[model samples]
Target chain A: MSTRFRPTTLTGHELELREQVRRFVAEEFPAGEYLPGLGINAEASPEFSRKLARQGWLGMVVPAEYGGPGRTAVERFVVVEELLVAGAPISAHWVGDRQTAPALLKFGSEEQKRRFLPAIIGGEAWFCLGMSEPGSGSDLASVRTSAVRTDGGWVLNGQKIWTSGAHYADFVVTLCRTAPLDGVKHAGLSQLIVDLRSPGIEVRPIMMLNGFHHFNEVFFTDVFVPDEMVLGAVGDGWHQVTSELAYERSGPDRFLTSFPLLRIFLALRARRAVGAEAEHRIGRLVARYWVLRQMSLSVARSLDAGEVPAVEAALVKDMGTTFEQQVVDVVRELADAEQRPGGDLFDRLLAEATITTPTFTLRGGTNEVLRQVAAKSLLRGAGRAA
Target chain B: MSEEIELLEQTLDALFARHCGPAERTAAAQGLLPERLWARLVETGLTDLGAPDSGAGLPELVAVAMAVGRAAAPVPLAEASGLASWLLGATGLDPADGLLGCATTHPDDDLRLVGGEPAAPVVRGVLTRVPWGAAAGHVVALARSDRGPVVVLLPAATQVERGANLADEPRDTLRYADVTAVAAAPAPVDAAAVLRRGALLRAAATAGAAGRVLELALAYAGAREQFGRPIATFQAVQHHLVVMAEEVAAVDLAVRVAALAGPDTEALAVAAAKVAAGTAAAEVTRRGHQVFGAIGATIEHPLHHYSKRLWSWQDEFGTDRQWSGVIGRAAVGAGADALWPTVSAPLDPAPEAALR
Candidate 1:
């Protein structure tokens, strides 16, 4: 708010990385041919993830020493945006590469990093977040999930809901209360890397309204999480988790979910002599995408500079998600185009988006909750006194 | 940035802050000029930011223009001389063409440039809603001629249809059957650039005004108690403040980034800035009013000053519909495949020399 971005251009490496991703995407996912999924909820293809890994595109921020390509956040931004708008099937590594890799890099033990970072970037491993539970949604610190010390490990007993892809995930980075409460609600919290194949665990499908099974209810009863599986120090889960909120909130994914929808909408209307109304519609969406992407990239650049612009990131998520969701609203009205899809490409995607756009806000911290966070930060910045 | 640029920003901010308070706002609602404000600004010699080697650049000019907009200062045109300076530079006209009121967006049908006594070129026609032209020493208008688009600098000594925008800001309509242009440049001049620059400045000003409104909403929400606590404690009210801040941030970045990316201001950046600014202004003003409630609906409050200007300025240069058509058509022409590339085209690499 106080200063503008350092007026500058992308590095040659960043530009080159962008081109590489474009070329890789062109060959793998031909435009207008394949069924482009909505942003991250697209296809879960390990084969495609491995193919991306071959191009040195997966776990892009992972250091080469960890058997991963160490790239800057801006470079990752360049690559992710192209793939997202293309609607590449990246669900296999979406959470792992976006949230997990950085989490491991920051708080994972060396042994854990060595064990998982290689497989993560190599597209051989998958993970799911166990943050949300039926009892605890936005008030995450109020989680009732408990991990009691037992023998050489901790016995976890909790039910995590809306756990996307846990049935297929190899592991779940579960957050559990590790110690008895000590007044502070955030205290006694810890993150445990729980193996999904452990006994006494049940993954129940929580189908989306569209009858899709991207979500699930995972019940862990006395599931053992070894001491080594702990991410960061005990009682430090609050700090670690909150530290990553900025990353999760302010990414191309936040704004580009409905980007593919906009692309398809424009493609259908572009060649036609679309009336001024249609053109105006296209213009509004494109202009929004341009600026929102700019805002998202600014967050990425700040991250690369080792700055945690949490407020800016919240601004991005609140604004970015709202913008992307509106694209769905805009495109929903255009389902009956003078020219649409191969039979019903635009129709199918619009249908998928109409059902899924609700999650665009709810999934990554509800926009209502986000607005409170942003408002408080802004008020503080304004030095508002009551 | 250099220390001087920092100083310039502070100086201009303080200059506007000192005068554009309740008193000036009250006088403005009565349709009075902010004479003291304008007089002080002119005395600072920062009015003509386009002056060659003025030790300031587009960044400084933009900052000042944004301050002007934020203050809702009831001043005339030349507060930010970017478009004027742009015309002077584009047409190779003398820098001596003082206080130019740009009249580009208006229809140039009746306006034509013709050979007169060789001392002064003949310009005839109408220029409507030219931002505060009555205050400018000269009016630079885009005119049509046999060669192509001509930009003529006419002295603003003639009578105009003195107009007032919703905010009571001056918007004079220049009507001339045959006016002598002290300076004229033809064909090679850029009319589109003039319009885009106007759009860019309007966008910048709107952004600033919206920013001020957001501040107002935040302050009010934090102070006004409702249901035994500050209204800011309410989730619903917080939602409004957050959305307003989001829109303000987006537009603030849009215009600042666009202007700082200079030279290409004629291209997509300016258009994008206008669209983003216009769109965000809609959201900001609506949410701001909602937060202010009945008090905001009244004219005595200062909220209307910013909101009215935002409404009027957004309609100027080109509107969301008009500019969106321009952009949407361009995107269409470029094809869907080229859409992302065009939208994501990067800023120029800023070398140290360009860091002012």
Candidate 2:
């Protein structure tokens, strides 16, 4: 049997990058500055994102010629981890930096790259995904958003639900069916770089459980996306979107959403002499977190080497989001702090985490869907070997 | 792996395949050691691969332990090669040509040194659940001396009452009234350090067994039919198999980190590895049995071999709960501000100074 799953240790450079990111977060986005458990969709300030871009953090994996720092995926992972742990508001530039830039680099035309890459790297543009429609949550292949071919462009008409940050995004990389659905369900679909400010488009707020307006229902009625704005080839939306899921699924964001609460709990627990039970509970959580981090880092390394690692990415997401929710469960069980909505930091963070915990396994492809994806791939591989 | 280690692994694999087959394992499980296989392993220098002079490190020993685990070979690879040889070489004893074992299982075993009167010390008290205590040529154990905790090597001629763990390996109880030591020296590490080493070895073995069980479950799911279709086609069985795979993968990475960790981080790394591996062993074995249904529970099926060993090994060094306590205490002690840094610090490979 091939030893494909051998463990990996970080290099000196990756360690250095991690330390640098940690120091940056501490100095710039200190613990008390922001509320905890804001989730990854917390509204971020453009100024903060620009500051990160100045530090050569944003667009880390994009090539230098495209106005990026040209770092490896592991380096990007270090930055993302530190930001998440610090509870930094990264939503402003998250989608554009994390997935949009990479997608543009891979499948975008030269004009599209020249037009969008620099703005994304400069933290001036925010991108929200337009994949999930009103009727197509996990069944993304059934997306009914149509893009009828016009003289100079495609007229988009459909409704996209759960579009995170659509209100603040400058553009949405909308997935639409461009041709008749007479062939394979995945074919004849295309990705269009639809400008969010175009005519005949409306963004309606969908408040979260915490009364946060981070999610939206975006409607596109005859929104004209020019041919120059198309991402990749027409009729290749399925492949392009699936390729981007690796980035969406294998990030530190999936697991670090509730990390701020954990940090507060640990700090509070340290002041008092908690008994062995608390210690054991805290320790198990930390150990599990460490394992998850290592596993996520391994996926990053694979991505750095330009391997898709779709199954591995799905595995990380499935395990990671569950661990993220577990962090909330553990803190709630152990913390003696009050659970009032507007009490001390511990209570407030605990409340936020309680509200946000349910979404951890729901977003970025529900855990059930991801498990099926991973299972099929793994069984197929095993069957071939057998 | 280095060229030499890879060659050694290939050699060991070939050796196990030739001599340590199902019949041999069954015999070993029936209260008998495969003497010929053990002799071959020792003579081939595979058992002493962890000696300082052997130019192999813990990573190499981990590889050997994993191989030993995959075959369920009834040898003291972990105890002898991993812990004993390192201890012997550290305390200035000859590590050559001895099947060594250690008695450091329980914390309350009151083994102490007495009466050598300016010469070597004599060991007393009882050490329970000592791995390979009856079969080993010598046993290295921690005993309280007038100075402090000293390590004493006792010959296997001491009185030993044979015991067995879940997997039927020799976990004997040794009673030493006045067993004279062949060699006595200061312990290179504390009892906790010794336990961590043993835990690391067991984690590696567990990972190997977990990997094997995952392969078994996968193959079985593909073949077994339910409702006139392969059970593997069902989402439920596939989910179980994937979870098993995830556990195996986590254990594999955790073991590597623990094995290669520096002295400063070794304790935390090992504790994490043990917890993850122990937990994984339980889940993987349970799911493996679930996938195989009743056949996996029967002794006739080979699946029970790996699953039983996993069940026994998870509790041998330290259960998940026990190690979780160790890790939890350490993290809480470090406090919130320092926890991330403490866990994410780059590993130092420097050997630790002798434990105080």
Candidate 3:
């Protein structure tokens, strides 16, 4: 309700950590040598993931007892922002380090944390969210992925569409309908950690707009999940999943997708005398990016300070995603990729961005829905301050 | 916020609540300068905070300007103390002249410098769009001379052509014809520096006004009912409020960070903030009008005071194209290698702002 985003500056230590990531990028993926990516939907390199984890940059928020270094959210933000701006291939460990480890720390049992957190921080484990089924994308409470109680575990049966990297994932923290629909739509649901290697599970590939296999139709049938695999409590799945929204919705990933392309555009512009249009384009894009980083970092710092910035996070995510897509449009318009069929990295990234931008808004939450999410929260907190 | 700023804000809030309203704005628009409200605010000595000897800097001026913008109080709080005193100091003007005001020179002003005696230099030009020119005790402007830029300070008794912006704020013009200058000298600062400072002040003000507009929209939507419920409950209205909130947050962050950045990038930072504020002024006012509907569009409502001020201030310092173009050129000049470093440049937090 308060439209204030408390400004956050990186501490000296956090800035040092940022330099470390920059040094790593310089060593591993030097400029003009690596293929830049669009946001987190870049190349999936397990080798790169392991290298980052060895640097203690993975599962940053996971407490030390569970193998992570227990760094502050802002520190993780510092590292991830550098990697994202550099367009590092973080896809393989992106979901696990970003979502799964936090889920384990918050809701995973001691046994589950010991088993999963170590693998996650080591970058040996990968995760795919099972909240979205064929019928439940934004309306996650309507998930039809049912789980029946068995002797020692639950039997899962349903299909999750648009599950990014399910084929590459080692486990899935799935949203399952554990009980009958007893009048209330949000009740009777539970989160079950299902192993992708379990029997009666199929990770069928779904080609994306960019002709990449980033998504999958993950079908589950009679998949047995032990009682220990249950996340939180039955009928608490809705709350548990919604709790992840802040972390998932607002992060460096929301805005840094097309940054590398902007870098490329700048590089090219430097070689020539850019006209007024290009200058305005580059200037406005950089302006938006700068403010978006501040906004995103504010949310991260607020989370670190134990604030539930649901509205703030939604504001950042929605605005950040839209700004990123606009980044693509600016670069494309300025680059004139249509005429330069086989141009340089600028053209190539522009092609990828033009195609992949639709997914940028689609991936976490569509712009339209996120706007409403933020608006509803705003209205709810009406008259708090004038 | 630091205690000083917090107290200043609280004081301003209470003062505005008590004295600044429809009557004050109406009186000022009709040429009275809102004497009672001005008297109350001046009692706080905020304008003196901008005096050169006071050591108050951009942060202070920005704070007061934003607050003035929010209250829609028609006063020379920022201009008289901030820009006027900050720039005219090297002109050897006596500080005893009281709350000096500065005006930006325009090409249309056709400013010229004919030769004059060393004791009394003459400025021959028409200073255009001088904010609070008619009300300012002493008006100062910058003109081009053979040596370099010249700072010309005009006494309050100088002749003036009164004008007004859309919000009905005074923007009087002053004409000179080999006129004796109260004080004039080779400028200690360039036109670019003056424009940058002015743009930043305007941006801060625009940010403040936009914030108030959002609050008003939110307050209105929460109270106004249609279709059996508060319009805020309607998804359509909520959408407008959310988008306005985004613009307000973005603009506010831009202005604050620009104010925080070190001298190295202050120009680009100010330019970027001005550009963002310009864009926000449009977006917030448009979405704001939609949320308020007819009531917001009325002359009786206070919304117009902020919206009209936003509209006027946005074009004052520099248009969006002018500022954004400067930013664009800077980025290209720095080259691609410095792109991220430039965009993600860390703020060199000012001492007073260290509390943040």
Candidate 4:
């Protein structure tokens, strides 16, 4: 939105961390382990995630005071990008480590941070988000999840669908309306951390088009969460959640999922030394990837310097999603591997990428939402100048 | 590297904003601008700035020419004037008196400069089409020789024939019948090398035009309504607009980087820039028309002007495909590891541009 470009080069620390991630990914989940037809392992294997913990990558951005490595956000970005590039099964810990841990560190109570973050940093705990409801798609304020004050803390009653990793996560961070104020939908909303093992919690797996259990319908019928688990002050959910969306949105993870397929396409074509047509396509894709990487890295640097690059983050997501879809489409075109074609690794990856491409725009807040965010930020920046 | 460069860019941009904005461009749709504009620009000392610094020098003119190109003005300011100014200084010819057009032929000897006179010494040859040939004062033609390719500054009056082309700019066959000429000192340059610099300048201009067009299309999509909602609300349209933005950004960066890559590799960079900008021009224009519907393609609309220039500028230097092959071969030749630095190094030197 700013038309302001940022340099895109990895720092020495980030490059070193990237090498470590690459080595880990190569050894643990090599290309050989990536069977095309089989869907990705639905749950992030605790053992493998703990392996990440050993490498001090699980909470790269969390502060050392909270038992994290206290590396900058850029380092975390490098780690997540490499993990997604390798198709690592991070679905189990992705949300908790990347989003919830950072958000809690920023706004959670000292007690709450002490209790949940150490385990998160160790990859021993996992969490899922409970924001979307039956009728609330990308509109966060439309959430009907209601949390009424009760004896112990608050009782949450709602049904959240399309909640990723809810079945395997230890706890669920939810946004609920605390006070039913008329005509003010966004106010009186609060975020609560509910244990997935609580009474009156139901997690039903929703198998997707590719036969992967990546989502669930999480129901909370009078599920009680202690007041201490509330992320921020009451009625401050909008500010808190919006701030966290920046982290959830901007990253290499958003676009690099299909990179493995790109590698396979390149390898297959490398046998013929990549003809002009394929080379042209790969060049264009790589160029776009390079630009997106710069923008995302800029946002990371902004965050590292303690600046809130909300609009820049939105721009990254908006462009990043398109790049991901483009990569998938190009891979499909290059491989010409149909969904149900003869058993082959190329076909399987294509099948997964095609089914997964739609979500690129839908996830991390829809592109429309991001555009609005960008437009508003643009107007705000213009106003300040004016 | 110097504040003077920034001031020069700002000055040229201001000049463009005052003289070559959409309104002025529309006014020039029928013919080139009045002589007053040219006289005024020359008065700014831009016309003579590119001549060698030793003799009324203008080495700094390339940057200024870049700014002029960025404006997409309907003039051979960059080609006829910019190149002429540089060549005049390089060849010890003063061009302050009037405009001079610099043109060149392919390395192939299709148009032979033999015997002083002939019955039909029609120089039936083509140079990469110059931008403002319809209005050039003189056409300088260069041909490959046993020594090298030397550019002959032929007066526009010496043309034997001329014709129209798809881009709407005038092109001609400048017949050279044994015209008396004094040998300009020094052997001809690598015409291809110099032509690349010219192409790079055009690519920068194309990039500027493409950026403006995409901006207009995006704003229209955001504010314009279809099916009872802003078209920007439509995911299909949003995706299209974003792709346009991506291409424009790529062209913008490539052209700027190429401009800094010096003369030899500038062709490849320029080719990459041209291909990207040209492709973006087509895509964004079509998408603009799609979003705006029938009204956008009409003569009454301003979008056509941008698209016209896009087409003209694209074919002027080289087709997008030609440049693609040029860039591709350079890339393949450079190999993988070194290729990144080769393409990306120019970008590293400009810390301010990178931050900007």
- In angstroms, how far off is A361's CA in candidate 3? 1.1
Give Cα distance to truth, residue A132, candidate 4, Å. Answer: 1.6
lDDT by candidate, in order shown = 0.78, 0.81, 0.80, 0.65
Candidate 1: pairs in clash: none
| Ranked candidates, highest DockQ first | 3, 1, 2, 4
lDDT by residue for model 4 (B53-92), tens = 7232122444555566456565556665456666656766
- For model 2, state the Cα shift of residue A177 in Å: 1.2
Q: After TM-score superposition, what is the CA distance of residue A250 in candidate 4 from its true location, in Å?
A: 3.6
Clashing pairs in 4: A5-B356, B49-B58, B50-B58, B51-B58, B52-B57, B53-B57, B116-B178
What is the alpha-carbon interface RMSD for each candidate? 3.0, 5.5, 2.2, 5.1
The TM-scores of all predictions, comma-separated, are: 0.94, 0.95, 0.95, 0.79
How well is each residue in B100-169 modelled by candidate 3, as lDDT tens digits?
A: 5678654456566787754357778788878877777777788778888887766663678888899998
The TM-score between candidate 3 and the true structure equals 0.95
Q: Report the poorest 10 consecutive residues by lDDT, candidate 3 chain A.
A: A334-343
Q: Give the better candidate number (1 or 3) by TM-score.
A: 3
Q: Count clashes in each candidate, considering only residues at least 3 apart in sequence or on different chains.
A: 0, 1, 1, 7
Tens digits of per-residue lDDT for model 1 on A176-215? 8999888899999999999999998999998888777788
In Å, residue A243's CA in model 2 sits off its true spot by: 1.7
Per-prediction share of native contacts kept = 0.52, 0.58, 0.64, 0.03
Question: How far out, in Å, is residue A151 in model 4?
Answer: 4.0
Model 4 C-alpha lDDT per residue in residues A154-273, reported as the tens digit of each score: 989999988888878898989888889688887888999999999999999998876778889998998888888788898898788887877877777766656666655554434322
> How would the docking of model 4 be graded?
incorrect
Better of 2 and 4 by DockQ: 2
